[model samples]
Target: MAETDAAPSIALPPRQTDGWQMLAAIERVLEAERDQLALWVPVGFGAGIAGWFALPGPTGWIGLGIAAAGVGLAALLFGGTSRLGRAVTIFALAMLLGLVAIWTKADWVAAPRIDRPKVVALTGIVEAAEPRPATATIRLLIAPDTGNGLPPRVRINVDAEDLPAPPPAGSRVAVRARLLPPAPPMVPGGYDFARVAWFERIGATGRALDPPVIVAPDGGSSLADIRTRLTAHIEASIKDAGEGGIAASFVTGDQGGIPEDDNEALRRAGLAHLLSVSGLHVTAVVGAVMLLTIRLLALSRRLALHAPLPLIAAGAGALAGIGYTLLTGSEVPTVRSCIAALLVLGGIALGREAITLRLVAAGALIVLVFWPEALAGPSFQLSFAAIAALVAFHEHPKVAAFAARRDEGIVLGGARILLMLLASGVVIEAALSPIALFHFHKAGLYGAAANIVAIPLTTFVVMPAEAIALALDLVGLGAPIWWLVGKALGLLLWIAHVVADAPGSVANLPSMPRGAFALMATGGLWIVLWRTRLRRWGVVPLAMGAIWSLLTPPPDILVTGDGRHVAVRDGRDGIAILRDRAGDYVRDVLGEASGVEGEAPALELMPFARCSADLCAVDVSGGGRTIRLLATRSRDFVDIRAMTRACAAADIVVSDRRLPRTCHPRWLKADAPFLRSTGGLAIRIGSGEVESVAEQVGLHPWGSFAAGSR
Candidate 1:
């Protein structure tokens, strides 16, 4: 042995080269993580779609064209020869395809834009009718009369003093109303209602001057008509307004009928997801159907012996999912669930196991490719986040070991399932917390506990009963089932109320910057998608995001788009609202953003504010700088004089009235023209900086109608 070692003590070619070794290592890593890398393809593509939407004006088109050319050149040069080069080509191609898909869809669905506000006669079929608590606030969807050069659809608020009944869908209606383009966000970084309306194809919104006349009676039953009828049936069976409204929402997705108090309670309790027909409900329906069908088929010896049980069950599940989606109006979430269900069923039919991550990602890609705008919506974001987190956690060896354990005893199995549910809820709550805070400025503190109680009741008892009732009603035998469904819903509502009434149930956090959310999402995805120990690095960015959120300061001042209300931050970090009238959406947004529950009582109670009937003045001092603001809507000459004097002493003057020529340079006028142009305003006192939603988001197709008016 010693002689053999001496013989082999020759040069061994310097251990291949570091560069070649590194390349080989990288190749191995790519081979090992090919599936993991494939999942990120859709993520990058979605980001590209969102980027196109975020770009200002026509710049997106130029960027898209460049990406397309780059993709083509990259494909030609590499063609999958080199792993690194292939990755670059794939990314370039995804970005290019995303831009192309969005551009094409946007053009195809583009509707006539409203240029000005005017009274017009609208005559079209009533696509939907939502009856509000106040009879006068009924919402009507009127398809625009063809060749009117109006948008394809217009949402009108009907003011009917006395009506026998609400207008049913499928009825032709005529109304005379003053139509105006949808309003923009009420403050900087606020919710963009106009953007939502644009995607809905609602070109304008208006208040009907008089009751809408039914030009023609209901002609035929459409999906909307069926939903309306089902909603009415559920409401009639329940008898209690709150419970019935909730029941109808679960059954038909008609949440407009729910009482405001009930809606708020559900949201505060973190049970709002139950009211929406999302992935949970869809999964529940499909699973229940599959289980029941399999059991029934097992009872039939001839069929069970001859047929493929898994394929049959999957087919039944797919059918149930499709039914639920159609019955629920085929919303974005419902559509996403249907896609996932179909993909899973297809896998089963092809004798392959369904991978949760791939299924979830495939569903998302399908939805985004068809409806690119949905990529920006909260439903899409939250749904995908929840599923991804669930899949990631469940895929872990520890979690899988726990889930795989079986207990033949019913009690022990029940306990195990409960524990698993609690664990899943915790994971989902953690994953969605930042997103909820960013989008809604609040997160339910007890969401995990609330979901533990609500999910089982909604999934096992309530939704199944609802599905059965709908089917029974097809044969005119649904009343008893509907009654039972109503009782189950009552219990659910009671749980919601109790949970929502708990102290500190909702955490009101200031809205974090978009960049912080990007960081958080990246870290979360990194941890979920990577298989190596390097995944631990994700905690660094996540922790950094949390720190950034904690350190970020709330806006110093918030001005409503209408210019009639303003909220200033007080010394106690509470919001001091200076308004003669209640600021509806604007007030709520500011209250949540400032972490204040209610409005500050008076100017004297405020940190730096003094007010009179004619004018209100605020002075904020921070970071060795002072910002003085004077705001008023009073038209009285004395009030105007007082405002002018205050303006002379202030750094920023806001008013609906015209400012004197001398004060023009320092004034931030909130006249009709200004409000129409800027939407809303946010001010930073320390830096004396101001931002408007219009300027921050810029003019895009969603806001094009309002921009056109400007």
Candidate 2:
């Protein structure tokens, strides 16, 4: 309406809004990120090609053909496709190749791995255990018992009979058993336990149920004896400090002295990861070392304010981290942490301002290329996912806005530390949740709360105190350090107990299928690695897969029996009965185990009654009644019969154990405790687990595994 409304020329500014800039920034990152798919393609081809020969039987030929097809397809795409087309094609093919390799490898599983059950002569060192009478796991280096070439080392799950007195980690022992590679679970999508054990250089695993017939012939001079002596010395020093055994475990991953109840409490609380001696622990050391090194550098004028000094400190931190990894015996988690750390350090050295997702992919590729079996391992999956998330997408401006607003202290120094920890936890825990749910079926709600205090305390106090105590012991000033160490240990134990006992402490979820987990993981990768927002939204596919499982249609082939009993019913809560403890494993395939992956299942451990009522809140199935029991138990205890009949009026009778002579009910003893239904995979949600605690009891028998104990 004014003078020039129609004719005024409007100035068109450049389309460079903050959002555009961010999009552009993302594009630049995509461009700068070297084509990891290109790399992954070649690596996959090689593994498939070479492994073709190493792999057993006809599947190798099938794999070879797939490799050829992939190569041909890759070439055609390279010759004619656009940049986007080629990148997408390469990624697709590489992923497909990886999937094929996974399935093919599963086919390669073999039985009768160890030569025979025997009492053979062997020599090796015990890799670890707290020195106290309560807990320890000893590894023995195995040889022909008379060979010049190095002998393969094996880890033996030792027990009370292995030694007159319990030994610390690294004690050399001579013992024997029927040694064989542990068998992976026979069920589809179950954990590949044996293969993982193999990667850690263990050829055979068996119980050290009986002690060596004789002590070392040359006690002081033998290498095994020497290691034992050194380990014992450390043990004595720790004992002298008068700290209870829990501290010993935190620092050493040896749970020899912790009471079983305390261990159980910690496991329930989700605070058990503190004792694992993995990345978290290494990071604590790194934090302390970095602080010390930076302070030292600051004292020297030449070092102060120099970017090079910071770089050097990072490098030094890497070395220290590696040393710890070695001392900790190169556990899978530690190895992954060390590898990831160095790669990050290298990026820093190269003057890189950003960490690309490709770096994470590259690191994972390197580890997998060498240890392909690790693809199935928990550490490998969890570590890489967490690292990938942290390295690339952990803190986006969008996600971090809330965080910034919450920080009222001007990003003060302490606040910065807290922020770093919280962010790291969110990234890593989110990345691990699906897998954890798939595996153990429970989530640790209190993990963050526990770690908030645990991380800082370990970083500033516990770790440093440990180092000081160790250093002092080398001289003669260990007593005071011991007292401090004891206090720290007590703090950790108390934290474990408190966290474990929290209400809503352990919610159970269901176990998800492996395929579903892989889909979710791929979705995360797509989200992080793809530059285009629309493409990244491919996470919707994974999310959909997860949700689909939550609404999994109930199964049709319901086996409500152990070996002895069989009852078929519509898949619903309180459906099956197991007789023998061994039967639980089998039952799990057909039904839910003790719930807690995501949406808790209703499976219970056997040899008890009133199971279904305890597992579910509402009976989805109409009330129908079935009761099965062993005659002996029925006659001996009227309570047993009453309890069986009261399985919330379940309409099934499957007896896997010996059927009651009068009841004549068919039952199965094997039950599935490893799975969940109607949702996600059940993970070992809390810190420590019953299995870990049970294993520890062999070394430290102070606690109870008494009958009917939880």
Candidate 3:
């Protein structure tokens, strides 16, 4: 009887193959995630924006044609009534919508950018002014008298000594300045400041050659004036530059006055987000307003009974959030937070689950729809990622149940809340690490631990104290409160310095490849968005991406497009530069990109390097091979025979002056002409590979704007 039963089971389908089993498993996951489809629409839309940005050249009508064809195909396929067909149709429409939206935005904001440095006399009204210790930056609304060739707006930096006092906004000023286009990426796959400047309508940036003379001073009130006044009041009140600067930042979102050392400490400690007005600050402001309004209303029992107190409070909160966003300069992070807060308020008013992933998705969609360029920026990425991670984690069935459980005592409940906060910090850090590394080449390893102490302090103690003090200042009764605010900020700064000084506080990583970053992002989204156990499969791609990043090696040689600055790997832990006079910005960029942590190694001091008046020779070893590099140090003339011989003997040659045709190196020649075309070069000697900033940038409109030579 057993044999007969086994024979019948075997004949009943011969058991499914591994492939079939896998398909069935995927089907089950799809079934489990049927309700989660809306979350993916934004994902597809973002992918479309990314794809449009990745094109090597302008597609013009070609992209539109392809999108049209895709939609038509989707329509035909969707007629079959299969789930796969329906999903495809939805994805196509979503992506096409994204493409159209971004295209329209880019075209709308396409303003002419300066392509070369020009010393021009600028006379315009000061749109905004940001004062610092050594310099003041003023964004100008260029007057029509400047000629049609100039941008509508320009930003110029003036030495503090040049200005007795920074010109106030709406004051007309005239000055001679050496203006140039906004800078491009310093290296391949680095940050693109030009794209950002383009969107902001800043066509040129420069330093003042002559002190700006005030042509007309207007007595008027504006948001910029209010912000400046507030900053000055806070700074004057606190007295301590660092603490006051931090306080001002918390209040007005102006961080220009913060000391460099303190700013670096905060960044290293992973608390720099405090200086940026984001969700944490916005929520505090809105919550305080709501609480105040509710209490005030509830005091009147007759009105409270008929008022719908919660809805009224929500409206007040929304208004406060909007006002704060505008006051804080409407930066990307603040804008995102305000939008999210408003959506949450709407959800609350409607009596729905207010803090769900759907709320986050809606907020993201709104931002992307209006500001598609923000999709590529760190502000948008980090803000959305942090909130999405928090929502997804707490929304877990187990986590929700645990959080819902009533504690037996106050201490137990407090302990539970702290434990959850710690866990949440860990998850947020993990989710954001890949993105941070991609943009900054490093991630704060101890940020989660530091945030545990810093977040509460900033949210409850520091912000409230500052707000109260600022309010009391108008009545001349804020000294005590300002003192308290300073004390709180002092403690917060101490925490930042302590955490930053901790060993292994920051993970200094090599530049991650774009593909690896994409893969990790996809895996992270998969894990965070799905509810089924099958989401564990995302770990495969996550692991693969991390391994790829760790395995990828830093370049052996880095040369600026002007060929005036060159850097080479010194040892396992250091970098060597060609000239001792290299600027701090250049040194920092090269060191960071080469995976060197901490203070940059002194330039032109490597044991394996030798320099003369006109030339530098460096020997770098990696992957069991040594590369000989020759670079020019100055414009001093050299004998052609000697130069040709030296160049021919080397593996790579770099020079600001064009090299002779006879001076062909074994590997690469990055002379003036080649460098002009390439922008910047990163070479891997062992792999015989080269990457250029220009090649990576492709033919984007922003790439044509010349910051300087490159």
lDDT of 1 by residue, 528-614 (tens): 877766468898888888788877777777777767777777767677777635645556877876666655554445656777667
TM-score of structure candidate 1: 0.90
Question: In angstroms, what RMSD does candidate 1 have relative to the true structure?
Answer: 4.1
Over 11-87, each residue of candidate 2 has an lDDT whose tens digit, in order, gives: 89667889668755755555665454454453443345334323434455566656656764765665334444455
Winner of 1 and 2 under lDDT: 1
Best by TM-score: 3
Q: Candidate 1: misplaced stretches above 4 Å?
A: 1-26, 64-80, 133-136, 147-149, 159-163, 407-412, 470-480, 599-607, 622-624, 637-643, 664-675, 704-710
Each prediction's number of clashing residue pairs: 0, 69, 0
**Candidate 3 structure quality by residue, lDDT tens digits, 1-710:** 44553444435657899976875676566777887778888887787777667665566335753874577476656443544456566767777777777777878888777888999888777888777741244334444245536887788888777875556677887789899888877766567788888787888888889878885465667897788778878888888899999998988998978988898889888888889999999999999999999999999989788889999999999999999999988998999999999999998999988899988888888889889888989888998999999999999999998888783799999899889888988998999889888888878888888899899999999898888887887798889999998898899899889988988888877667888888898899889888888679889898889989999889878888678888787776777778777777787778778877645554457778777788877887876789889898888898899999999888899998898989988888889888777887888877877888886666666776233223
Give the RMSD in angstroms, all C-alphas superposed, for model 3: 4.4
Worst 10 residues of 1 by lDDT: 701-710
Give the lDDT of residue 644 in candidate 1: 57
Q: How do the predictions measure up, each by TM-score?
A: 0.90, 0.66, 0.93
RMSD to truth, every model: 4.1, 11.6, 4.4
In model 2, state the lDDT of residue 157: 56
| Clash pairs, model 3 backbone | none
